[model samples]
Target: MTSVSRYMSYRGYQFPMLKYWSPSLGVTMLGVVGAILFLAMTLGPKPYYWPTDASYGSSPPIATRAGWMALALLPFVLGLSVKANMISVLTSIPHEKLQIFHHWTSYAMFLLALIHTFPFIIYHIDKGDMVKQWKTSLVYWTGIGAIIPQAYLTIMSLPFIRNRFYEFFKATHMIAAVVFIVFFFLHCDFRLSSWDYFIASGIIYFLCLSFSQVRTYLMHGIHTATLELLPSGLARVSVPTVIKWTPGQHVFVRFLTPDLHLLTAHPFTISSVYRDPDQAGKAPELAFYIKPRRGVTARLAALAAKQTGITKKILIEGPYGGVSTHHMSQFDTILVIAGGSGGGFSLAMVDEALRVSGLHTGEDESGQESRRRLQVVFSTRDTPMADWYIDEIESRLSQSTTLPGSDNGFETSVSVHITSKPDLTRSTSTLDSEKGTAGKLPPTDITTTGSFSLNIYRNARPDIPGLVARTVAMAHANPMPNGKKQRIGVLVCGPASMLHDTRNAAALAQKRTFGGEIEELYLHSESFA
Candidate 1:
């Protein structure tokens, strides 16, 4: 199928939205420019590229005000979106376009703000004599602070520079955002617009952001958030969520504590839909069955040691863009690729599938007659992490043996691919001791009737070829159930690099001309990195 059909069939969104939102930014370009035009039209002559309002000193330069409006627009647009979770607002745009908008608008904000500062700068440069008094002026200082963020923001906006120094860029990018917000309050002297759209926008941003903070604060009073290690190595964290998850999505995380400065919230694909709706004052509890990492996962480990209730506040905001397959009809073959923490999301889907597997399989199977296979490829860098949940896995596997209404899931197929096992400088137990355990899955593997197995290795680089090997081994295992187009769909989540390669692999595999038959493989990915 063509890209449009695939997207329309899977995502249930207008085809134009994806193509325009594609890295080349075909559509967002027009939208953003149009927004700029509207602002310009409301303010002056140059409605597209130039800022018409240059007046300063009086109240706020019209240009300055408009710049604030634009800066504020991003979060405002986000606040209203169903996906607005403070945790991963960065997930709003596609990678390439995200980079473009993140850079350009930021630089534009900086330039506009800087241009708006011109009168002040001219006035001050005229009087280096009045430097001391000028520097103390509220407007002057606020503009200066804004300038500080602008400089860093501008530097990071450069593609090559940002690529070269991504860590510093990310950190500074976040810092710049906070700084921008601070300078905004100073710019407005905190009263906010006081009424109308400006006030409404400001309030919305405040409530959206502050809601997360206040909810967490009330839940976990002092010691930072707690991480409860569930029995199956699935860490149960009661994050402050305002509502139910839309399913098949993930978010970025950051620690609330001061000491763990680098203890950012790692992105974990959300596992399940929020079951309760009427629960009051209770922020949604997000779940993650994390595959332990050494240095990076230390904070989660620390939380696993919690004795009673939540220690510190945990921030949660997100229902980021999720799987395209959320809307797709249940297909014949569903190949899910979960590497490391990626499994959190896929396993959640599998959990849902396992519960319904019997309804579609064996003697009494019904709706799933059209669906033939349930294939999963799990690429992990740790082996024992698998051991951590093997009990529950085995239980599920056994459950497959005895269908609720029948016997032996001779109908479906299940496969797990363990791509690698890296040396963990730290262990899950050690981490568990520090942070209290959350919860666990049962002790059983998931097995259907055909080709159930686990493949393991210790490779330094888990590349496309390796992934292709495992996936192909699973796909061609039984000749795609007698001549049906192989029709495989993949959902991959892991390191961004690995996900990209997996996508490439899936594409490569689909391009081949088979013997008297044709097959198509579809790939999807979620990146926490």
Candidate 2:
């Protein structure tokens, strides 16, 4: 599909305000439900049983059909579980993007398994052979064993439980999945086509797993990572390597330290843009800004606190899930919204904006009347984090201006909303030292540097809807030189509340595109918390 059609399909609606699924997802789900219903109606037991006088067996057909349907879903569940898989390769959808479908498919399979289980019990109990079957039949034993772990996997994967006990969940989820799959394969007991489904699932999972392991160990390999604790209570991990990645992509980093996450790999968004070493004459670095919550992060933070700069051996698995650079470059305006540790996400986008605008390339402007605009809206409660963010922005803007053939008309603006009171008792010197400042925090005073402007708001939250509306309004007010309507790209990375507000705002703005007020408005959001 074309990008425009894809964007429209994926765009969300505000009505039924709590609904999170896009039009595309809703339609896909509807199709899945419809297919399930059709299958159940067509293949379900006609009389629910055959008479003892008849030639056919007495067991209900619904149980066998449900079991087959559940078996057919195994390959899909396994395919979606892997980061590197044929589904993602064929569909051009990231593994992370397929996560929702994976979850739903697993739920469907679990439901089918339950459906498959109870019918056998009900039928055998009515025939007065249920207790005998349980005691004697291997099929009953294997089926029960499979369902028990399947139940654990399903229940523990619920958002609240999974999020609260992530480390435990992650460890046990794999073990349970293995046990369930093994028992399920045994439960089939050489049934025609049942083994085929298991074989397909196993092949899909193994190939994906092998590819990922090969990529991680051979292609990417191990690298040293410097971990520094930022004043905002975030661990800043910097790994200099020959590997290159696009803006907004994330990597799964396995820290090879016993006290830290020795076995498990944690995902973190890459905070810096990749520059080709051959072109730049230096190895590019992958940077990650991580907020400490629990488990691995908390341990990393504790280590970072004791030592300002610590080094560890790490292996990175991917450069996955980012907006296409070609797609992003088509926009006339770029608006980025971020909150807290989402500052890192915003920085990578800003870097890409500068690169796409030819600021990094030092290319001469094409002499258009209107400039390409890049606007950033950040909300945070940490004073030090706000300072650090401003410093990073200032450094980038300063570098852009110094580059040869920089565009004079390129406009950039930043609005930082600090949602908490600044601690007056904290030593300014300590803060300055951490940020490499001149023994003082950055002034709260509004500053305009050439084409760049910065605004700081103290003890207040950002007006998300207002910001989005104003941006669209400004685009409408200023027509492009070529007489084409403006195309805007809106990227947001923040908390769920922030994402919800931004999504609604963008949805409202998208209506203007239909009215000819704009050409297109594309929104991409990532939840940070």
Task: Highest lDDT: give the candidate number.
Answer: 2
> How well does candidate 1 match the true structure in TM-score terms?
0.57
User: How much lDDT does candidate 2 score?
Assistant: 0.80
TM-score against truth, every candidate: 0.57, 0.90
CA displacement after TM-score superposition, residue 222 of candidate 2 (Å):
1.0
Give the alpha-carbon lDDT of every model: 0.51, 0.80
In the range 410-456, model 1's lDDT, one tens digit per residue, is 23333344445444553423112111322221122322232244323
Name model 2 segments beyond 4 Å from true. Answer: 1-45, 51-55, 359-370, 403-405, 422-449
| Candidate 2 per-residue lDDT over residues 1-529, each given as its tens digit | 2344543444454334643333343446665785678466536557655565676664567777778888998999999998887888998877887786787778878988887888889888878998899899999999989999999998898666788899999868889999999999899998887888988898999999999999999999999999999867789999999887888888898999888868788899988998878888999999999999999999989999999888999999997888888866777889999999999999999888887776332232544466677899888998888878877877776677675665634578888888888666766542221123332333353444455777777778999889989999999988677667889999999986787678777767867776789888888777765
Instruction: Output the worst ten-in-a-row residue range by lDDT, candidate 2.
Output: 430-439
- The candidate maximizing TM-score is 2
Least accurate 10 contiguous residues by lDDT in model 1: 430-439
